[model samples]
Target: MNINRLVWIIMHVAANIKNYKFSVIYLLLMLIVSCRRSTEIGAPVVNSSNAVLPAPTKQLSIVPVKIDTLVNHPVLERGVIGEWDSTDVLNPSVIKFKDKYFNYYSGFDGKLWRTGVAVSNDGISWQKFVGNPVLAPSISDWDTGYIAGNGTAIYFAQRIYYFYQGINDRGIANIGLAVSDDGFHFKKHPNPILATGPAGAWDSDSVGDPFVIEKGEALYLYYLGQDSVGVQRLGIAKSVDGLHWTRLSNNPVLDIGAGGSFDENGLGEPSIAYQPPYFYMFYTGRASDEIRNIGYAISTDGIHWKKISTTGLISNKLRSEWFSKVICDTTLIAVGGGKWAVWFGGGNLPVPAENLNGQIGMLILDLGQQRDMTSFDANSDWSRSLVKSTDVLLGSFEIEGDLGKRSTWLGPKAHLTLATTDHAGNSMAGKPIIVEGWAPAQFISSKTGQYEPLTISISINGKIAAKRTFVSDDMFRIEILWPEIAQLLDHTGFVEMDMSADRAIVPAQFGVSKDSRNLSFKVTRIYFH
Candidate 1:
């Protein structure tokens, strides 16, 4: 039989089989047999059932490399020195002046908290100012009790302006301003720049954690406000001269998370940084679990905000030493090489004594790395939409499983569409994109007739670029890669997905309490790399 005729028959059978992997294998074998018989006079007849196929060649595996974000250097640990910072030190704010790195932190003697200064050439090793407690509490002033040792500092108008939180005799926290000429000694202003809001306001109880950034001709101060109900939120105020401030009409710009959320309890200790088109806010989120971890949010304008993750970015799970109790009072500074460093106060244990006895830890965040673009987790900021058809409903779903509660549902016949521009911005084009995730096969089988394979198709610019059909009787992991598309660079496009049963099917559970049309499969994670 002619080799061409034999190859055509094999391809026809493979197409009817509906298995992508087997079809590719058959094609390769046909090529091998044809190349070997090129010099022969007549085409060799090949047996379909007994023909020997060469062993498949292994493809080179490529491992992705990620830049290290968090690099820890405990430059301000307690008990390392017995000077003015002998007892405890927390709340670190860093500023660069001329050639040295100025580290201003809060220190506690046996009695009260006071502000102190330490200078370093490289930001690691530090030497306390000869006259420590550069700005101590005044005997007869509003900030007599305590002055925040670790607060925000900036150089403007040929002077250093330190913005700190002061607790008065009534224990009410308020914002204060101090001016430093030489970056060492600071002179406090007469009155509190920003006092607590009116009784019944969101920030009625107290205000603290001042994070200031200069934009345009005005300086914006973002702080933590505790209400009479004890719910802490974020509020903003603006000042032109660095002393007097006017609170925005939309006070409490960021409120507590939804019920049963990571920051559901309250929010506190905000740190803000401006990186051109976006301003990043890092703060401490208090969850109902009694866990306080670092959370992140981003904003195009200083007022409106969007959280980066549903859960805390830096949690006890990330660092075992910090235990899951406390990680707050963050100060972010750009370290220049497409990286940012965060200095925050963390406690070793969850107890109160340990909380008060905190130390500063540093972590770096790589801005060049790819981040998650989907939010199946209830806590993320990604918006999920549910699409309904006659037989099935699809999108992010909530299902009860052996694990208390899970949000892994990707409804049968579901369509998931995400904006690539939001995650990649202008740098998306020409970058290698990988879509990888897993789903529970048993659940999917139960819903779409019985153990039928599901087909997933990815479309770029409304054109189907890649498709895969996989059986899901067990845990199914799927990864599809698309090479760089030059046209996608800097342009906005939708990465659309269609996940449906291979054949016409009905919901697995007909009389279930939940809507059958709403039943979905568990989608572990769907992200681009």
Candidate 2:
């Protein structure tokens, strides 16, 4: 086969793997993929013979939510007597040790920042180590000052490694590694595993918040590198033993390039979770707070990344919430039984004086919420649609959950997505496509701030047709614009639509009704036309 055919075949095989089960077969296939060594045309040999394929792509969590959400946002440890966990809770790293959970954190102790430990039965509630401050500043000949900052945490077989930022008295930030046999107690390394970046590199100034992940025998470290300009970017290095590292001469594994992009300002605090065929990373930056913001990017190999999207993750949420100011450190844990917990450290308040004494509070992850996101993606695979610049789309999801469980998508804004595909499922960029929905319902669509009898031309495939320039006051009609949508139309595809054009009344109170209880809300009824 020609090289191009081989490449296309590989891509085709990759896209379909998302449909199978995960097992040793999958791991062997993944190993073969990892061994490819190069993404180039002549990439190394891949064993296609009887290799167990990767699990099928069930769904993508384009949107995430808080589930099993903790009412008391910033969990306080009983061992400590302070509020807001003392104000910092800067870098929160959590791991599941058998059945219990452990949280390793880095906060200030009045004078300087250091690391500590806390225990938890359920992730929501935590207890600080009576003998707190599991990992502190460095005083060895190698580490001169303190554990400047932290990155996401990970658990490996018998050892727990918390990658942290070590800043010397000279204020030079470098990456350091600490390990623990048990989650509560830790031992710091006498030598910094990875130091500052080369003089003319994107991380010329310093490297901080190292996130160490072990992939096979090689341990890949993802961390933040700062240049003299103070612009923070992400870099990657690999090791076989989690010590003695060799920098990817072509460092700056990730960076903000060109215009005022969502990730333009910078991408720092690299966190990695070995999820299937790829290693996923969540980085924070200036675009993190944009109303349409949520910082993210993906990678197959720890070195080369795939930008699923440039737009930020978890955007335009809680602008007023206590921790609304930022969305940093996206942490996820597959705590068995298919539950994923993602905790973030982003609040508006400054580090309190009390917190300066060593305590900090940040947002917690609701694994149930994450599971819902997975279900949402599984339930409603996302596809894009296009409308005139002045059009809006109204849509809602009917989710069934046990008491105290709920799911939430990131935003309601109808994204004007234009991709390079035509109605025939082939690349057709810069070509016009209709923007109509099979709105089988008579109720109005949420045509907020858009054309009423909206008629517009748009290019790109306009993936799944879920949104349209329509709305209704009466909640009677059911909408089923799925991801694998049918083509846009002009005829009476949508039922109960305003056929008369303007002289029609649409209901607003549509969708499933709810019954509110003392503790939670439940969906009692689902209405469909």
| Each candidate structure's count of clashing pairs | 9, 39
> How does model 2 score by TM-score?
0.52
- Give the whole-model CA lDDT for all candidates, comma-separated: 0.55, 0.43
Q: TM-score for all predictions?
A: 0.56, 0.52
- What does candidate 1 score on TM? 0.56
Clashing pairs in 1: 69-364, 70-364, 105-149, 106-149, 106-150, 310-379, 310-380, 408-523, 441-472
lDDT of 1 by residue, 376-401 (tens): 23233222311111111134454434
- Candidate 2 residue-wise lDDT, 241-360, digit = tens: 666666665566576644667666455655665432234566655443321123556443356565554655554443336455444555556432222455555555322111312223
Model 2: how far residue 464 lies from native, Å = 41
lDDT (C-alpha) at residue 160 in model 2: 79
